[model samples]
Target: MTDKSRKPVRKAVFPVAGLGTRFLPATKAVPKEMLPIVDRPLIQYAVDEAREAGIEQMIFVTGRGKSAIEDHFDISFELEATMRERGKDMSALDGTRLAPGHCAYVRQQEPMGLGHAVWCARDIVGDEPFAVLLPDELMWGKTGCLKQMVDAYQEVGGNFISVLEVPRDEVSSYGVIDPGKADGALTEVVGLVEKPKMEDAPSNKIVSGRYILQPEVMRTLENQGKGAGGEIQLTDAMARMIGTQPFHAVTFEGRRFDCGSKTGFVEATLALALEREDMAAQVRQIAARLLRG
Candidate 1:
């Protein structure tokens, strides 16, 4: 799967149009992507991952009430002025701005599906190969998941999806990959099955919501084929491109927290807080104290 003739992945498309129904009232006014794992929002982690992967432009497929996401990446004049007056260090806000042209927002008008959300950004993505990062899936590591995928994409130059081995029983909640051959972290993806029953799953390696896809996938999504819950599933579109192009998966070499769920969110909060030197000791004490009750 070594084809280096493909275009460099410069832009990243973030599908953020979902209603975030899983989070309920917390997400009623706020976009799920805005929910903070610690001090940083989920979308910030995703944007940072894309930036680390050398992605130049960010295409956010957003919906109504998603303006906070746009605001998150934009420069706030008042806040900066206040920080300046208060003699606060501005270094913390250094990576917040994406420049003007670096960020583009497209509206996904309806609650379609991941495929439709991605397709909504087609015009912005153009003909070049691009990356996709699902913000809710917080992938933490020394080298970000998208960066790892980009490195693999450079060698393989087809389509790469970040994967991680979950338990077989948990496969029903995710898109499982039918593996062909494995070479270290990279595996030849023979097929993709979206949310298969546990007994029918091909492998426990579930798609981890980070992707480096060729532009051709946009064409497949344009057809709007429905599968697995009668929605235009992205896995179905990627599955069609399986043999036609090189499709592979990188078993992510990092911790992933599914921030969309309450338990996963709490786990991520604690885990990430424990990573910070400033918060680790206090957080550990708080956890120990709570457990003693």
Candidate 2:
């Protein structure tokens, strides 16, 4: 059961220390999180979602060559001044800027894994429950996914993980959940299996990138040993918390694009571009032409 007096979740952690080896040369100097989807970078979408979910502090776990990500969120006075001089609308940047003192950064010195990256923010998160968002997963919906999870967390309240059903064949790509009881969109998670093969998988409902975890999960991660891929896996730590707390899975009521992969990135770019009133017609025409050839 949730502690009625526990403080509300006001902070969010973003782990972005990975080297985008798949994108190669393009990501040589530019961090993959800085890649643009239409006009906004991937990281902006996650930050915007966190803000919408009432997250007050944005904590970033970064590494070498990731300075670009930090600068993107910082004030660019020169550019803003030039835009004002040119009589351009600056409203587009309104959501992107973080208020002074509302942001913090921690260094992930090694390329350990997602679990370690999240652990790096242990001090900032302190004793409060916090949200974790992976920028590579772009979720589109009328309401942000984290906000939906937060709403669910308010009711059930231990650890809330955003989940989505994937094909059985693709179960190996994610951490599969063993559901216990169903209650509309929320399911009681009995067990979790990280990247299990099709035959070993428990269910098709896989854990997505959004999480609402109690501070105790940080304690679990403190001595978490390496699991799959020989690295400390967040899934491993989360699995240990299932029975000890009120663990539940909230299915996302939206489309999710895995922007970390090349194909998913292109699909997300096209999907978002086609949604824009200004670019829809032209993008449709171009898509039609490409499909015909």
> lDDT value for candidate 2?
0.92
Overall lDDT per candidate, in order of appearance: 0.91, 0.92
lDDT of 1: 0.91
Per lDDT, the best of the predicted structures is 2
Over 151-224, each residue of candidate 2 has an lDDT whose tens digit, in order, gives 88887678889999899999998888999899998999999987899999989999889999889988999999
Best by TM-score: 2
Query: 192-260, model 1: which lDDT tens digit per residue?
Result: 887899999999999999998888899999986687677788888899999999989999999999887
Q: Residue 229 CA error for candidate 1 (Å)? A: 2.2
Least accurate stretch of 10 residues (summed lDDT) in model 1? 1-10
Give the 10-residue window scoring lowest on summed lDDT in candidate 2: 1-10
Error of 2 at 220 (Å): 1.1
